[model samples]
Target chain A: MSDATEKEGRGVRAVETGLSLLGLFLDSDGPLSAADLALRSGLSKAQVHAYLVSLQRGNMVVRDPQTGRYAIGPFSLELGMSRLLTLDPQITASEEALKVARKLGQSISIAVWGRYGPVVTAVVQANDQLLNSAQPGTVYSVTGTATGRLFAALTNEAEAREIAKLQMAEVTPPRYVGACPPFDEIHEPLETVRRTGVSITYSFPQPGVTAISAPVYNFSDELELAVTMIGPAEEIDISLEGNHVAPLRALAATISRKLGFIGKASGA
Target chain B: MVKSPERQRGVQSVDMAIRLLEIVRKESQPMMLRDIAVSAGITSAQAHTYMSSLKKFGMIEQLGDAGRYALSDATLTFARHVIRNDATLNANINVARSLSAEIQEMVTVDCLVQEQPTVIFAVQGPRTPSLSLRPGTRSRIGNSAAARIFDAWSDTPEMNPNLSRIIRASGYAHAEGTPVPHLASLAAPVFREGALVASISVIGFPDAMAPEPERPVLRALLAAVSSLGGSSA
Candidate 1:
């Protein structure tokens, strides 16, 4: 019998079926097809398939190349990452980011690439009443900032330049974000990131806030992700450009290892 | 890469079940039980039974205002386990064999099933005596490079909480064959989307596999796996 026969239920049947199919993935280790979804969701096959096609086009789902089963995709990853950061990106990042925030006294932040410049993921607060309220889920701009260069490195020159344009157009003073003078300084630092494999920036996103940013790597020897800690000038380590780089570098490397990059020794 | 082990004396009901699934995969839209039965060369009664069970598992979906059947999202899980590990062995075997060449040992590719390490395939060099570690034997997740690779590839947050850190710190791992002390093995993890899913290992007698160009061999082996996959998550 069709679910429509039930009292007080009609269109809701399919929506419930759709949600139930997504729930099945929690029990499954891999992908699932329409049939699997129907079986797991206990809905009529037609209703589930329709919702899936719509989900696929919207980037809410991913189709497996081999099995033709569907699962969560990049959009989901972005959402998942956002939620994780909200719960204290510092905790998700674990001990080192926490340590950096505490030493600095000014609020410290570690951010990664999100739709906005850098999405502040983890944060360590300072004692001051000024209260820099940049929360974990907040997105920062690539222009006129430290994490900006790291975000720039995520893409090629053209993409960064394009991002710079959009950012400046949206902010005050209305000039090219790339035209910011500090941006010119980033070219050399980014090159160092590509070479020596780490980067450091001064008085980063906001003036009076100095920062250090580093890339986490693994056995693959690829600079796939970046981590940055930003805070007020007094608590920031200017010596870090040389003396403390290894700590941040080591922390990034450790995070990279945890993320499964394990570098040269692992066959990469 | 190794295919799933073929089953023997499999149930007639299971065969019909698979055939029904295939029909849905091939069909453009939902098919009624009659259509499914005809396609699978079975009676409608049998097809109805299969469909009833399949519907319970989320593998098949019903379509239209009326009841017709098609594929659903759940089948991908079964396919991923096979497909993900397929490349793990294919791109890795030659590299593992070549690495084994310098030490004149046996090279093998392995994966995990529920953390039970199993040799999926192996190639023994001429200098070494043929080893008994054949494909399809399940082993402990401890004491082998292959196990480390499997644990590393797993997405579970606390995979191998005891040794994961050590394996990460050390890079690649070595096995003195705690499972079999005479056999010394070395393994490296293959990562995909930032998770370790497979391992390639070279194994042989400790005396015969003396320290001869092992690092270069593993490096070459790792490079080969990287060619087939992204370096990190």
Candidate 2:
């Protein structure tokens, strides 16, 4: 190899080893010791020691005083937050969700279709009821909740079927099999939601709870998020003509508009 | 300028001392001199010499009666200095400070680092006790509000799908008197673009943050986060 190539190769190897050491923390159940890192990274304890020193200098890792295991340092936290700031949909939707929740005296959840399913991206709750509602980062089931139904209505048929399959597998306590509807039964409601552009469900996923969800579109007019309003069934009216439906639709529309949806498309 | 061999040797000693510090930090617990020497690939005698110098500089300290060594307060001070200077952390700290002042409750900004929820910045409210707002504290992902937010938004697979669903539906996590006694915490996620970046939490005594009073605090926190996030974005 040329001298420059050799120098670059050495640099890449050093970075690889350093990155491998950092990667170990992701799979670790807790903090890792140098010996543990050495054992995992296939590096000698001495080499691990040197790498640890470099990581520490960069503030990439920290040692717990009580456990004596190396954990991610504060610098990594800074980087993680910086990366999260670039997600425009979450920032825009979250601000709107908070405002709607306060105005309606209900809980609002904004969810995006994640690889796992519909993952909640943001949530805001009005006080005086359901203070312990769904939190951000929670995932919704395609078969069980309003948000899920909304996603099932908007998502592609093949992906929706895959989510449905996962949901079927998720129904625990085989004896409670009757509680989870068959796939065919699920399709009817999803089809209705797709046509109407809104989903209102009661006593589903949880008893005595009601949820109303509408879709938010992005610049491409794809289903980017679902905004849902949830509360107790007794207090929240889920009827088509109820007080919450119009405002909920309006909020979802407002967010969709913010996302550059001009409302030209109907199915989205 | 070329250094004299003596000055070069001095620089090597400083490097060795830093290596010793790294070994102690890697263990995550206090380490004995023999173990430190073995980890650093130095003799116990050499390790002792380096430890003495590091202790003199307040970078390392000896535990009582035990000959074990650990990073000292000075090391944490250095870490705190880095946190203060970091751009993202500085902005979060300012938002946390303003929120704390407005709500009169301790506010913390936590992020997922190495898949662990760790606090990077904290501002204690006037009424809150000094004991709780330490930066760099870690909480269990399943139990704390901040950890739950990180878990819910992170691409990592969920540990409990049911809990994740509930947290997603709720939009915020609340743990009453958990991770700390007599302290209840409610945390909301702060997003940038469409990704969850961090969680801003308000912690206070349960009675002080009762349902009625907490409404305003939650509203203020959401408003503060929205404003801060808008500016930062």
Poorest stretch of ten by lDDT in candidate 1 chain A: A80-89
The Cα RMSD across the true interface for model 2 is 17.1
Candidate 2 residue lDDT tens string, A1-268: 3554544344445554665676677565457998999999889987887777667665667766677678767654443332222226677788888887898788888887765567886778785776335677676766667887787777655565676676677635421111345556778789889788899887666778788999987533357788888888887777676788878888888776654444432221
Docking quality band of candidate 1, CAPRI definitions: incorrect
TM-scores of chain B alone in all candidate structures, in the order given: 0.53, 0.74
Off by over 4 Å in 2: A1-268, B1-19, B65-67, B126-133, B157-159, B166-170, B180-182, B192-195, B207-214, B230-233
lDDT of 1: 0.54
lDDT of candidate 2 over B1-233, digit per residue (tens): 53322332222343455466656665666788999989888767667766765666455678768878876534433344345434555566677777876776778888665567877666555456545344456777655778887777667746588777776666677777766677777777776656777788888887755434247876777677676563212
Cα lDDT tens digits, model 1, B68-162, are 88654344332222333245544565556556555455677766543456665465544444354544445555666677656654566235565
